[model samples]
Target: MTVKPDWLRVKAPQLERIGNVKEILRDLALNTVCEEASCPNIGECFNAGTATFLIMGPACTRACPYCDIDFEKKPKPLDPTEPTRLAEAVHRLNLNHVVITSVNRDDLLDGGASQFMACIDAVNSVSPNTTIEVLIPDLCGNWNALELILQAAPEVLNHNTETVPRLYRRVRPQGNYDRTLELLQRTRQLSPSTYTKSGIMVGLGETDAEIRQVMQDLRTVDCDILTIGQYLQPSQKHLQVNEFVNPEQFADWKAFGEEIGFLQVVSSPLTRSSYHAETSQGINETLSTLKS
Candidate 1:
């Protein structure tokens, strides 16, 4: 394993606050992408009293090599009580913004879109003031299922184009680059008011130019927000780190993304799809200004 660079080191968060958040999740029997994916921002996000809920599973149907979430276990049926419990946790934590993501449940007919809708409705019922963001899977090109999720009217519709097209076969075997772009394109067309967001991870052997091209492709689809981060190997069995991109390079990428007209760009070693996600609220005001 390659040694992590100094810039990638994360500070420990206040455990008391993290513990409190964990207690709420455990009590509700909810799963979080933070814990399941081994996100580096877990302690920080949890300490700040927020989490990206992983509904429908801790196990995913597709075994992406870069992800840490388990793929060996079979996906189970959606729990009817899950949305309510997630809502309760949000209400208890008094979150102003919540990100709901899921492992790919390809086994389901709607690809778990209904479960996402149920979660959104449940959250809205208990915490009407809280804005919702869902980091969703590709739904296997099921546009009908995508429409179902859009009809639910989440504040932000996020689908990760996790890697560049060139590495799609190796890095994200089951993922299609064009399909990822189409999903974002469809989101913008279906709900012009809803913010469209995507994320990519660096250091898996992609060139700087390839990264920029991906950013441009995202802008072409009118993606409103972008997150670029460094990829860390979760275990020796997972994909090895190809390179450790420096912080300055990440800043350059942010600048390039903004130059290309992304409404918001978050680029850094630790930036995740949902990390500091609440900050995108500024985009609402920006878009409103543009329209006026």
Candidate 2:
């Protein structure tokens, strides 16, 4: 019998401005992770005056079982002007911290790394003061592709592990757990100064010990930040939630992460990868803010 975890209440201030943000995005013909990935914290993130920009294209090459992004056999060619358009969108939104991500485009030789760089550059050029974060794919464990993105110099580099290794076959059949770790390790090696972040979703049949191990593994890769949250099934067609983790459990994980040497950890039932990112000024800044 499946048990519903107690619904942790959230007061999302961002919901109020969601419609206006949607209208602006529609006007610009842009896509956001908020709409594409079915992120639970979309209402909160948008209401907080922030949105994660989805670049490259809406269609993905790989179909991760847990994700709801549409998979196309042959995605459309890269949009040459998408970077500038994304920059314009960021400028218009008046975002202080822009979070950019993309669909997995394994069809391209560079694994869409060039396009990722272009978007970062464009955003930086237009909004110099605004800190930028890129939540990237593993690029099939390509070192060169990793270098291209690091060269662009985003404030934070994030790549989600999504779930524990044991659940990889069921939750993320197309993705590699080892490859994701390698990618994170490479990012830190390539640019030690860049803040490296990763996330995992609980309630996927993973044990508490397994979750703790995952956090330890992230620390092994020199990850600077971590976000852990409950996994909610996006649709009937998607993978069913194995369990619902309570708010107390999330708190325990957060404390564990800090003990394991993670500089920052955001663990809550309602948390998503990019949730409350706009408020995380930087590792030191966030720590100071939290303390004061």
Candidate 3:
């Protein structure tokens, strides 16, 4: 028998300006993870007045079994005007905090880092008060590419570890676990003031011990923020959910993560990598004040 956890209950509220928001994005010819990735919290996020911007292109080079992103052999060229367009979208939406992510562009010599920086610059130009968060790819573990993004100086630099190292072969076949760790560590080394964040999806057959170890690995790399969420299958072709973790388990993990020295931890059924990004700034600010 399946049990629906209390935390999984989604309440749909009417978003007054959500249609205008959608029309603006449509007019700009931009795509969003909110639509592409089929995020379960879309309704809530939209109602709460926030959305994650998908930059670069819709085509990704890696074929992670758990992700539903299209694995395109050759994607279109980077749009030079995408920065301005995305900035306009943020302004139109009146976003206080914006989360920007992109498809992995291994085809580019710079691994799309320049494009990421451009988006950050564009957003900053228009929304000077808005906090910028970037969910970046590994750039194939190249520090030079990472440096370009660091120079832009987003408020948060997030690179998801995705899963435990043992599952990398099967789950993220083309992704290197060590490379991800190095990327997160290097981001901190490059900009210690920038809050470094990463996330993982549970219900992928990882044990409690393994999950704890993943937290330790993140801590060792000095990742300040962490998000743990349930792994819901996006499609039949994607990896199946091994188990739907209970809310109590998620609560226990959240407490464990805080005890492990993570400055902030978001672990819940509907939590995503970019969920509650606006509130996150306050959490990071609080932690920064404490550190000082």
| All candidates in order of TM-score, best leading | 1, 3, 2
Q: What does candidate 2's lDDT look like per residue over 1-292, in tens digits?
A: 4555458555655545998788878888889988898887777777766799888769999988788888855688999889988898899889877889999998899899999999989987898777788999988878899999999988789999999999999888889998999999998998987889999999989999999999999999999999998887788888888878888899999899989899889998888888888785346464333223
TM-score of each candidate? Answer: 0.97, 0.93, 0.93
Segments in model 1 whose C-alpha atoms lie over 4 Å from true places: 284-292
What would the per-residue lDDT of candidate 1 be over residues 19-137, giving only the tens digit for each residue? 99999999999999999999999998998899999999998999999999999998888899999999999999998788999999999999999999999999989988778899999
- lDDT by residue (tens digit), candidate 3, 134-220: 999889877999999999988889999989988889898888999999999988998988889999999889999999999999999
Quality of model 1 by C-alpha lDDT: 0.92
Kindly give the number of clashing pairs for every candidate.
0, 2, 0
Query: Model 3 reaches what TM-score against the true structure?
Result: 0.93
Score each candidate by Cα lDDT: 0.92, 0.86, 0.86
Q: Rank the candidates by lDDT, best first.
A: 1, 3, 2
Better of 2 and 3 by TM-score: 3
Looking at candidate 1, what is the lDDT of residue 75?
Answer: 88
Model 3 CA lDDT for position 112: 94
